[model samples]
Structure formats: C-alpha cells, structure tokens
Target: MKIWSSEHIFENPWELVVRAQWRKYPNKFNQAVEGIDVVDRQIDSKGVLRSHRLLSTRWGIPDWATKIIGSDGVGHASEHSAVDPRNKTMELKTRNLTFCSKITIDEKLVYSPHPEDKNKTCLKQEAVINVKGVPLGSYIESFVCDHISKNASKGREAMDHVINTIKLETVELQKEAKHAMESINLNFDI
Candidate 1:
C-alpha cells in the first residue's frame, strides 16, 4: 500500500470555493474527467447535503499496468461527497471501481474554512494506492506509487486552475451587479 497526502490553502472564501466545487467538472482544467453522472443526491435529516456520483476518466497507464488492467486505458470511479453548511465543512471520497483485481485507488478530502482567516479555506487530501495480485509487491508498488503521484500532481494543478477561474467569474459578476445598481440609481434620481 502507498499513501499520499496534500494540504492547500485557497485565497477565496470557503463558501465560494465549496460552491464552485459543484461546477468544477467539464472544465478545461479537468480534461481527463470524461463524464460525471449523479447517482443520488439528497439532504439528510441533519440538513447535510449528500451525493453519490459515478465518474468516468480517461487515463493512460504504464506498460506493466496496461498488461494487467488492459490496454484501452480507461477507468471509472465512484465518488461520494457531503456538504455541511452549518459546520462549514465539505467531505469527499473517491474510489476506483475498475481493475480492482490488479489495483485500487481510494482518495478522501476534507475541506473547511481557515481557522485564522475567514476569507480562506483549507483542503486536506489523502490517497491510498493499493496494489494486489502481484508477487513482486515492492517493485510493483514503487512503480504504481510513482504513477499515482505524478497523476496527483496534475490533478492538483487542474484544481487550482478551476478555482482561479471561479474566482474570476465571481469578480466579473460582482462588477456587473455594481454597474446595474449604479444605472438603476441614476435612472431613479433623474
């Protein structure tokens, strides 16, 4: 088993960041994520929103993995997330369902408003890479770990890009609202 974790602080408020999370899919930054289908969504008794999604991703695996998982290079994962507005926290988990006979990837994320800075948010991400059905466990583990690590780096960059785009869009919307208010005020004064 290989473990990896990351921590990131976003300049945007937690609320905005969480809201933008829903729109992150289908963005240019997340090109590898081919599709997402909402399997279930509902607000629990505690008012926490819960959702399950089936995500399809197109990923290229290495030669050794290709032989084991197949050569077509496509994988699917199940994602589950919860939004707790009252607690100002969002939690998510993703697990690869394809090629389980060879390997499995389980990822979890916990997001919350920064304790010191209300305008910022903190994200803690962890992933467990489990390789199975191999006698040379150590050697295969190293290679699989390296691949997941590289893929994770790309995923982090893409997430940052998506967040920045959301921030820009928010700023533009604020500017438009300000202009509309000013125009309305001017017309009323005249």
Candidate 2:
C-alpha cells in the first residue's frame, strides 16, 4: 500500500533542530504510525544463526512541552534483536555539510502469532518514513553563518509556529485515517 511521506532539508541549525525533533518523536502523540517490525538475527563465523536474545531498550522524553519547546530526548532504547548476515551495511565518509536528502514512506499490514498465546495472532499496519541525508553546503556557507546571530531570538518563535502547524496536521490526518480504517472494519484485529 502507498504510505504518506514528507521531508524537509535543513540548511540552518534551527531547521536541523526541527528535523531532528520530528525524527526523534514521530509518534510523540502515542499514535501507532505504520511500519514494518524488523526482527534481526545474528549469524556466527560458521554461518549459523545465533539464538541469543538481544535485550535493549531506549528511553525518550515524555513531555509535550519539551517537544514543543525543542528539548531533545533523554535516552534511546537499546534495540533488541539478533543480527544476521542478511543485513547489509554501507559506509560513506565526507566532510560535514555536503549531502542530499531523501525520505521514503512504506506501509504494510502484517500478522504474527502471539508470543503468549500460540493460537492467537496480532495484526498491525504501519506507516514508516526513512530519512537520509548527505551535506549539501558548508556550515559557513549555509544560512548558519548569516542567521546564527538572529536565530538566538527568532528560532524559538519560528519553531513554535512550525511545530504547532505540524502537530495540528498530524492530528487531523490521524483522526481521518483512523476513522476510515474503522469504517472498513480494518482498524482492529480479526
């Protein structure tokens, strides 16, 4: 299924803050944003899948005001999963501030057997947006140099306006989607 995707390139530190905030708290409102659940498996040198449970948890800021005020989160939950050879890793290095940006949203519905009750199943459809960037300009060449001084006073106001608008749009879209899903009887599990 097609998923809604949105992205903005950040040229100024203030813009970066906004982008980071959205990335850090895509579901700050506790809405179940759609996406695939990845279960990673690790492989040993002998090419055998390891059977150990990777236990990890990440913590995050829980205050709406903090998000609105542009306060970054406190901690990140460690990802719990096994690593496998099927995973691909790419490494690229460059001087800061030279890059392109892209965001992709994917939606899918999935079903898996309940861990506690073998006979039961769980169904969830998620919308996930992945973001990537490569620097496009030097920090000095970008707006940072010219706007830094003014940003101290103007950043907060601009951020508040942008964030408020985004929050409102998210709420309306979520409500509409939820209602449509319910109307089709696809909002809950079978």
Candidate 3:
C-alpha cells in the first residue's frame, strides 16, 4: 500500500534530474485494482487516454506523512486533458491523481567574458533540486523515478563536458588575440 521514492539531479549540459520509487501500480490505469465499473472510456483531442484515480482520498496519502502531520492535510493534485476522439470537439478529462512526494530542479549557469578582459571568459553556475516526502501509488512511482534519474545523470555528464570545452575555447581565443596584436606591432600606450 505504501512506497518509497527518491530523485537526484546530475551536472550536465542541458538541465536534468532523475527520480525513483516503488509502487503497486505500474501507471495511472493500474491504480484501480478492484474492477471499478467502466463508467466511461474515451480519447481527447491530444489523443491521450483519460482515467480517474480510483483510490479513495484517504488511501491516496502516504502512511508516513499521515503519522507525522496527522491527517487534515490536502495532497497534491494533477490534471490532464485529452481531446475526445469520438467527437473531436469535446475534450476528455483523463488522469487525475493526488500525490504526496514532490521534487523540483533549478539550474542556472552562464559563460561570459571576464569583466576586465573581454578576451578572457568566466563561468557562473548554481543548480540543484529540492524534494519532499509524498505518497505515491504503488510501484508506478518507483519505476518512473528510476528512469528519470538515469536520464538526468547522462545529461549532467554531457553538460560538464560542454563547460570544459567552453573554457578551453576561451583560452584559445585569448591566445589568438594576443598573437594578432603582436603581429600588428600595436604599441601599448600604458
């Protein structure tokens, strides 16, 4: 009924992070174990299947959070929209679930010329993700988290390589500039 999950961010070219979790259901569809009467099934404009979170509101919350926070707390909710394939004009509301766990990543890096020397380069950076404990539906969350973490790690590696390459290019440019000045016999006034 309960699951554990975690996510990590990687240092990469494009921003990326990975997450992992263990859950009972594989995805949104499997959440409803007991054969809930198929009230409806349809596709929306975007061509996505829509389904409701079958679990009762109470079961949706993680057992851990409830123990610490003591009920009376609202869980996180997600909404998805899909265009009805039958009508094409009407949109179906598919896949709405409440989760307790949450994670976010923030990356900010820049490469710029040094303030005093235009030819010199500088690298600035700050990146990380903050995650909080939350209830996830079965093993579904775990599967997704693992996949994301792997992708993020790869991205981080690529980004680090790019940063190094940029640094080398900056140094080469500075050297070329110096050589050009010497070839022109430019006299330094100061």
Candidate 4:
C-alpha cells in the first residue's frame, strides 16, 4: 500500500472553490477526465447536501501497461461527497471501479476556509494506492503515484480555469441584464 498526500491553498473563498470543483471537468487542463454523471443527490435533515457521481476517464496508460492489464486504459470511479454549508466545508471520497483486483485507488479531498485567511480556501488531498496479483506491483504503484502527482497539478490548473470562466460569464450576464433594463426604460419613456 502506498499513501500520497498534498495540500494546496486557493486564493479564492471556500464557496467559489467548491463551485469551481464541481465545474472542474471538461476544462482544457484536465482532458483525461472524459465524462461525469450524477448518480444521486439529496439534502439531508441537517441541511447538508450529499451527492454521488460517476467519473469516466481515459488515463492513457502505456501500451506495456495495457497489454499486461488486458485493458484499453479506460477507467471508472465513483465519487461521494458531502457539503456542509453551515461549516463551509466540502468532503469528497472516490474509489476505482475498474481493475479492482489488480489495483485499487482510494482518494479523499477536503475543501475548507484557510485557517489564517478567510478569503482563501485550503484543500487537503490524499490517495491510497494498492497493487496486488501483479508481477511488478511495487513498480506499478510507484508509476501510478507519479502519474497522480502530475495529474494533481493539472487539476489545480483546471480549477483555476473554471473559476475564471465562471467570473467571465457572470460579467457578461450582468452586462446583458443592464442593457435589457435600459431598453425597457427607453420603451417606457417613448
């Protein structure tokens, strides 16, 4: 079993960070993630929102790895998340559904307000990787860990791109709304 962890601080508030996280996929930076589907969602009695989502990804595994695993590198994972609005925190857990016998990856992520800066949000991410019944288990574990580290960086970039896109869309909506209001006023005056 291999454990990998990382921490990052985003210069945006917790709310925005959570929004960006939900919209992170289908961005330019993280193309490996091909699709996402919401399996279930509900607001609990405590007013916390819980959601389950399935992710479809093409990890682009090397030919050697594909041949060994007898797979074309397509993978699926299920993610469960809870959002506590009162606490301003979001927690997500994901596990692989593909190659369960040979390899398992469990990942957890938490997003919350930074301890010292309310304007910033902090993300804590960790992944546990286990490879079994494989000839090169340790080597494969190491390779997967390295690949995850690289993808983590790209994930952050994707979040940033999504956040900026949201901001630009908001600006455009405001402009359109203002123009519509002006047109309405001009028609009323005439």
Highest TM-score: give the candidate number.
Answer: 4
1 versus 3: better TM-score goes to: 1
The C-alpha lDDT values of all candidates are 0.83, 0.35, 0.38, 0.93
What root-mean-square deviation over C-alphas does model 2 reach? 20.3
lDDT of 1: 0.83
Q: 24-46 in candidate 2: lDDT tens per residue?
A: 32243322222322345465685
Whole-model alpha-carbon lDDT for candidate 2: 0.35
lDDT of 4 at 39: 97
Candidate no. 2 TM-score: 0.23
Error of 1 at 93 (Å): 0.7
Q: Compare the candidates by lDDT and give the number of the best one.
A: 4
Least lDDT summed over 10 consecutive residues: which range in candidate 2?
A: 89-98
lDDT of 1 by residue, 64-91 (tens): 8677755567789999999999999999
Candidate 4 per-residue C-alpha lDDT over 11-30 given as tens digits, one digit per residue, 9 for 90 to 100: 99999999999999887887
